[model samples]
Target: MDLNISNIIIASLGLVGAMIGGFLSYKASKSATQDSIKAQSEIYNKTRELENRRIFENKRTSAKIIYIDFLNAIDEGLNIVKEQKRQHVGRAPNLLPMNTAYSSIIVSLSEELNPEELSVINRLYGIMEKVRHDILNLDYILGTYDHIEFDYRILLVEVFGNNYKEMIETNLEYITRDLIVEKIDREYKKVFEKLRVLGELNTYGN
Candidate 1:
């Protein structure tokens, strides 16, 4: 029970020490919490970037596959036309028009497409659509006229001469051996090269 100045000083020092320790503990805990939040934010950002890249890759692969398929179909159709022209008699060959995959794929990835790519795809799509429409119109025209078992296209060619195949050539030149085919082939090559440069190359060989 010695209430001297030394005892009072010791008690005061102990209180100050406890307060400083408590403040330091609070500061450490706050700093740790902030660091954890920052780390979580960084992880979230990285995850988003990875997901975006994956989506872009998938779209690119899909576009390449679709484009190549359409190109193959065009080649096949031209070959069919050539074969039919050489060997066909009586009935006209049924030439199925190309699908709308070109437009569909382009629309799906519209957000990431550059202006040149977009323009190229749109032009190609337009050509495809116009060709499709022309084929349908030709079918209608042939349907209206009655003829023998001969191929309606051959009949039309005989009836119309050079003017008859104008639309067909414009639409079919991409896949045919006609003189116009070279120009269309060059256009396709330009577009495909651009796609390759954009990192949208397909797994399938050219």
Candidate 2:
């Protein structure tokens, strides 16, 4: 009877030890799974941060160049317009090939540029186009292109002389550089200042 009891006790002890080992193993497996999930979450966050940083760097580099060029073009174009207005003549070609500078800024950064800023640029372009049209049409109607230099002049004094110039000048006086250019400059400066953001535009029209 003693031997039999001893054997039973040993079997019970073995079963209990097996149960304990299983519980510890279950706990270890759960902990490992939790760690794995945590590791993946951290990796995902780091990858996203790197991606965002790269995007910002791209905007700071490429977009910055475009904005500066556009600004310079505006400044130079305005100066030329002011000069021509002083002489009442269009001596230079198409006011500095405005189409190129205008298209470059608008097209390349089409998606990135701000809606309000885009509106202002478009408005300025429209005004400038109207002024060009009137001057060029006058050149064609007067046959001044053939006789005199096909120049953009507030008055075709070369063709009509001073006395006849008043009639043509009246139509353009409202849209002259003096009358409208300052407003264009102001609006443009406001739009550009926003794009001049160093950190994120946070730059370029966010």
Candidate 3:
């Protein structure tokens, strides 16, 4: 029997080379898979961040619109007194719009709202309820026959000489300007502070 050390060494070398190749291939495949997973995770994070920003922006826009509408309604509410003095004016004399606007602003960014903001909102709701009660009392006095329309409002001032309707208007203006509007300003500033801060931070990046 002839023993060939060269051939044996060559065969051993070939087996080691194949083993090394397989190990390297496995490592390369694992690295590629890890890279793919990392890329997907980054993409998911970016997408989630963008979605969050979109939601925040939407909330901000909704808050702005509701606030503007409430301001307009407040203007209308406060103007009811002046409107009573006028002989003829467009739109009726009612706090319904303001009430509706206030209701609409119940909670847009509730998470961003502090206790003070919530308190002010409750106070404003209370004031609105008082205003509603006054209106109902007036409606009862009027017998709800024709409803509290514009003509009735004007007629009350003409006949009563700014007694009933004008008195209510004056009262509404006082409470709204003093309590409701004041608290609204204070609480709105505080409530929206976090939103503003987050918005500024988002401007940079995640």
Candidate 4:
């Protein structure tokens, strides 16, 4: 009888030890799984942050290049208009090339921009195009007469003179001394402001 009781106690202790060991092992496995999940999450977050930073940097660089190109086109256009004004007898090839360059930049900017920025840029471009047309028409009329007529002078004053004055008073700067250059400068300012707004929105979105 004594031997049987001792055997039973020993078996009971063995079963209890096994249960405790199993509980400890399960706890350790759960902890290891949680640690792995946390490590993966940290890695994913870091990768995402780096990608976002790269995208932002690329966008900023592109914007700067476009802005510089726009400024250069405006400067070239103004120089052409000034030369035409001074010579009074010839059509300026400079204007055509500058216009082409400006158009290309506008197209590129439109592709790069979001819808809101594109809309503003388009409106500004349309306004500048009308101004350019007016200048070209006036140039033709002046060339035909070899002198400015009253009617053509009136058209020029209305389209270029008054508009230029308004732009200057509003703090816009032109690339040339000629007032007609204000047309391009004002339009460039509008584009710049719209781009700035778009950039802010992009940053906030990110």
Candidate 5:
């Protein structure tokens, strides 16, 4: 009976040990799973951060290019205006190319841009549109009545007269090429300042 009791005791001890081992194993597995989940969460957050940075950089780079291109277009348009004045005749070519660049800027980073930047850029575009429309109007007049005989000045007076020229002058004075360029420089400086602060402009060349 003592021997049997000893065997029974040994079996019970073995069973209890097995149960204890199983509990520890379960706890270890749970801890490992929690650690794995935590690691994945951290990795996901880092990935998201990297993605956001990339997108912001792309927008900034695009904005820089657009700003430069638009300024160059303004320069070209100014040259055209000077040429028109020197020649004293001929219709101005459209400034539509600059307008297109502005459109691209709006599409790419409209939401990202500060409200004041948006307003200034849009106002610049509006001025360009007016200039383009005027150029087109002049082209239409020249095309439609090129054969008319008279001094170009007299012909213009006869065709469009004081009212049209006065209106055109007013529009031109309000949004002169110099004014457009000045505004662009001012607004671009502000934008670049912000980009510099954010360190967004540094990544542009690469």
Candidate 6:
């Protein structure tokens, strides 16, 4: 009877030990599964962020290209205006052509810009609009006189002179002309410096 009791107790204890071991194994598996899920979630979030940054950078670069093109058109128009003014004693009616070209360029640039870059582009657009308004006022002044008289010439010179000054001062850092190209290059370097940070983040996981 004593031996049978001892055998039963030993059997019961072994069964209990097996149950506890099985429970611990299950708990460990659950914990590992949760950790794996959390790690995967983190990776997915990082990948999504990197993709967004890449898209933003590409859009910004595209907008910059269009802006640079528009600037080139503006410079060309300015050169034409200056040359025409120098050659003709009176207000030549050629301002309309130049103004139209500048307007078209601005329209093109505005269409290409993404919303993220719109603020800076809009500011530049506003400046162009002001320049256009000034040109229109100059046109009215010139139209009042039948021929390019001394007074009319002086008004033309003053208005256009101021316009040129404003253009030069505002765009000195962006103009690609050889004389100012070095300054523009420096400005471009700064732009790239900002871009590089974005680029590194984008390429990090890859």
Clashing pairs in 5: none
TM-score of each: 0.55, 0.49, 0.54, 0.52, 0.55, 0.41
Model 5 spans with C-alpha error above 4 angstroms: 84-113, 129-206
Tens digits of per-residue lDDT for model 6 on 144-184?
42332332233323323434354445443454443322223
Model 1 ranges with Cα > 4 A deviation: 1-7, 84-104, 107-116, 129-184, 197-206
Tell me the TM-score of model 6.
Answer: 0.41
Give the higher-lDDT candidate: 3 or 6.
Answer: 3
- Between candidates 3 and 6, name the one with more favorable TM-score: 3
Between which residue pairs do clashes occur in model 6? none
Model 1 lDDT per residue over 1-206, tens place: 56788898899999999999999999999999999999999999999999988987767765665456445434433444444343543233344344566666676667666767677667655644554554455554336222212233342233224544552555543433333223344545555555554445542324
**Number of clashing residue pairs, candidate 1:** 4
Q: Which model, 3 or 5, shows the larger TM-score? A: 5
Provide the clash count, candidate 6.
0
lDDT score for residue 132 of model 3: 51
lDDT string for model 2 (59-159, tens) is 56544554554433443343343343435444432432345345554544456667776776565555445445544565443444321122223212221
Q: What lDDT is obtained when candidate 1 is compared to the true structure?
A: 0.54
- TM-score of model 3 relative to the true fold? 0.54
Where is the poorest 10-residue window by lDDT in model 3?
Answer: 197-206
